[model samples]
Target: MGVRRVAKGVGDLLIETLGEAVAEVILNLVACALLGCLALIACLCWSFSPRLTIAGAGLFSCLLAHGAWHTVRNPPKGRRRGLAALTAVAFTSTAMTALFLLLYATGCDCL
Candidate 1:
């Protein structure tokens, strides 16, 4: 009876853990995709109007926030490296855009 209970407990643990693992993978992939899209949009919107650039970046930022929230809600799954690369690229693009706009607005008067 003792051996049977131990085996049954192990099986239950495996089932629950596998389900959580699968969920973790799905959530991570979704997050990765959102980050990738943000990076892509940021790259392409360099020459776009300030309003559109800001709007696009804002939308992606929200998506990223959502993904981040989920990641935090379920701790234990490791972060994917690709997400970091995507975020970095997006941030670079967004910063450059903002800098360019600021310079344009100020007429780069320092020059």
Candidate 2:
């Protein structure tokens, strides 16, 4: 019974550590994505033209595709997987939103 308790304790510790690591990774990804968005927005403001707007939208679409690829390739297999997946989805969605906004600002219709 004592050995079983020790094994369970170790397992719990491993799980906790994994959870922390995954959280840190997700945080880093989010930070990077936000920075990218900010830079894109700044560029758009400085160059308020249709070409610049289209470029911004293309950049965002690329970012979304990259994130989706990462999410699909690695996937979240356990407790950490769900958080990782969520992070990817969030990043992709934000990029798509930004792209749409850029398109709208440029008076471009998507059809």
Please provide, for model 1 over 1-111, each residue's C-alpha lDDT reduced to its tens digit, 9 standing for 90 to 100.
999999999999999999999976665555455555656776778766778888876888875665555444654457535665465556566656556444443332222
| Candidate 1 stretches greater than 4 Å from native | 47-111
Off by over 4 Å in 2: 49-111
Write the residue-wise lDDT of candidate 2 on 1-111 in tens digits: 999999999999999999999976665555556556767887776677877778877876676676677666754555545545565776768767667555443332221
TM-score of model number 1: 0.42
The best candidate in terms of lDDT: 2
Residue 2, candidate 1: how far off, in angstroms? 2.1
TM-score of each model, paired residue for residue: 0.42, 0.43
- How many clashes would you count in candidate 2? 1
lDDT of 1 at 62: 71
* Pairs in steric clash, model 2: 76-81
